[model samples]
Target: MQTRRTFAAGLASAACAAPFITAAVAQSATTIRVSTAAPPSDFLNRALERMKADLEAANVGIQFSVHPASTLFRQGTEVPALQRGNLEMCSMTTFEVAQQIPELGYFNRGYLFNDHAHLRRAFDGPIGEDYRKAVSSRMGIEILATHYLGTRQVSLRQKRNVKGPADLAGTKLRMPAGPEWLLLGRTLGVAPIPLGMPEVYLALKTGTIDGQENPLSIFSAAKLFEVSEQVVLTSHVVQPVFLAMAKPVWDKLNPDQKKAVETAAKAAATWGDTARLDDEKTIVETIKGRGLTVETPDLKLFREAADRAYTGADATKAWDLQGLKRVQSA
Candidate 1:
């Protein structure tokens, strides 16, 4: 058993397996794809471009290919794709994924953050960390970071100003296909038609839907103002974006690589947030120049309705009344 022939046989076996181990290690350095539902010109899309540059400079052999407008996957497919290892990363609205994980919808709550600073603090604390862990455990994804995507504004086909809840009655509101949006529409007593983004403009033009809820960036980019010129500053909900990576992809990275990606993601989020705010200002002026009637409602009724909606069935596990109160307080 201790003969030279036996030792040589064992050596041959070990040598045969060496290439397989090396090949497995080499596969870890392969490309990773990231998807976004937004168009190429979107603020978050631009941020992804920056992230690509940073990753390049950092010499991350792991290539990152950014797919815009859901080329790789749709908004609803983000979590599932990442979980199933079909996609490596994604940037999406939390509410979009909240359909599967209800707790994520809290990030979309109306008037949840008074300003950008408050939002950053709340998200950088225990609440955001908890959310990330919950998703990692339940949804099988790693949330690298979260940021304000955009501020939602109301757009209508008619000239009726949305000054209060009464004005919204009987109006067909196009909301993203999500439970929270449906709840918001139900609370306001409007007929909510859950539809995709591309279908929104045509619906408004064809009278299929009376109006749609979106931020200034979306309305302007989609040229919804062409069909629905009336813009209301309901600021109904704050659009929050979460940048998530597949857990398997993340696990493959060395600690240093993970840190670099994390830093780059946070930087990208900051870039996106700043870009969105600047675009908001520009779009506001542009909408005014277009002679669109933008109204600032009393906001009291909308706030109350949103609070009640959150306290209703939608509140279960998504967020706590007290936690939201603490966030508001902060």
Candidate 2:
């Protein structure tokens, strides 16, 4: 009886080990890697950290992690990487994905939101839903959630007191590399130059450019205030960030894992978006405390300029314009 019991225990152990052996024989595996453009010190970084915790808290039987500062791909290469399945997932800017899906710019159209509440409503409601569908269908990528990186405003190098939109006319600015941004500059009669982000500080120092448009966190992270003594808040557009996963990796997730990821995505989006607002105010005050001048210029005129520039562009229709207008009014 004792000998038979020992044999039975051995048999049970062998049975449990069989699955691992088969799985090992079937395929090689890797951690589910998520990438982001922000350095580890930024709020986006913190949000990703929270996501990692939430996913780990799930106690799921899989490896999950994040790669920061484009370790997997360059800053703008995020969506293309998603298409090729070079990486598992990413949380990136809309402009980075614009080439693949023009509709990804939906959240950026016009002066879309009066405040954070309005912005959240638009994204959590019909406008955000439509935008997600368009990207999923047109871009061949999955949209987990969309978020705001804070409002775009002008940060200037020299102490030119900007009282209104007319101040931007003839100002040479370093715009992101794309036609839409060029059109935006031309609408205001500003000479727009496309320069890589790393080059902006030296460009400002050497007087290569007069100003730049970015959310306050970006300006602070890049230390733009060292050369740029003035910050003019125009709130021209809300910079949109998206969490996306490669279709292949997305397909491999079990139903429960998929639901957990989706839930974490929404939570991360909300955390990153709201935390950015707080960071923006803190950074602006810090810059001002260092003796820099900050002002909220003619926001109305700036909005009009953005509207005039975006009119008739193919990218404009990708956004549910009526829905956005309702949110704006709300």
Candidate 3:
């Protein structure tokens, strides 16, 4: 009683790189159900859609259903759903994974990654293998590839001079609910408010939240500029999300289908990464065209505060410092 609409895989055409078992001969074509909080406008969702189309078009003897905008599960619930066998796939953030496996919080730390390349090297190297094993062993999930969304910057409801953390002591800022995000919010010297992605716009519009932070591309796609006034270019953390699938679901897939899923996931991640990197080059001007003020605060002061937060705070007690060093070396 899935009731989810999907197409049967067509015969593999000459256009396809490999042939899949035809639907007529295959009795176990499972549908991969993906849940994400990103809206259709966000590149993450678009990349998921592309992955769906790719698999279907390749006649991979499987189906894909991408439920965007938290329509399937709320922002923070997809991981649990995947663990419970209620979901098949998702883009799980490091912050969410660290919530369950605290040691992985190293990846979610502020100023930990210098750029997307550094993040990728850290993840693609041996350090990342340990993390993959931990998540798979404990969470019943298998990660496919890294999705680089872009660097996070502060988007405020009111235009002001945010020279340093002291400039925003009482500001009510929305951070994704987790010690990692909340700790970073406190490091930025704001009253960290936990809010889901879907609720951010209304909260900002209603003046319930003073500001939020995300990549420039997401800020533009989410239309936060409509409700906000300025963006502080903190460039705090280069965000990376894992294209993860339930291990149970993966175990059910034949080797061919598993390979297909991995291929599509990596291709989609590349699609998103390329688009976001290209967008970052000009999105500053794009938002400015929409009449939003973009400011570059002294990132040095912000980095110093973040250093103190990582070393002096209790949250880092569970972080993998060895892995942190490996990532830094990467």
Query: In terms of TM-score, which candidate is strongest?
Result: 3
Q: Go through the candidates in order and give each one's C-alpha lDDT.
A: 0.78, 0.74, 0.88
Root-mean-square deviation of every model:
7.0, 4.3, 8.0
Candidate 3: clashing residue pairs, number = 0
Candidate 3 structure quality by residue, lDDT tens digits, 120-175: 88888887788889999988899988899789999999998989988988999998
Q: Flag the better candidate by lDDT, 1 or 3.
A: 3
lDDT tens digits, residue span 266-312, model 2: 89888988788778767777878878898877667776777777787
Sorting all predicted structures by TM-score, with the top scorer first, yields 3, 1, 2
After the best TM-score superposition of candidate 1, give how far the Cα of residue 269 lies from its true spot, in angstroms.
0.7
After TM-score superposition, the amount by which residue 62's alpha carbon in candidate 3 deviates from its true location, in angstroms, is 1.0
Name the runs in model 2 displaced over 4 angstroms.
1-30, 96-106, 187-189, 312-330
lDDT of 3: 0.88
TM-score of 1: 0.84
Of the two candidates 2 and 3, the one with more favorable lDDT, higher being better, is 3
Q: Which candidate would rank higher by TM-score, 1 or 3?
A: 3
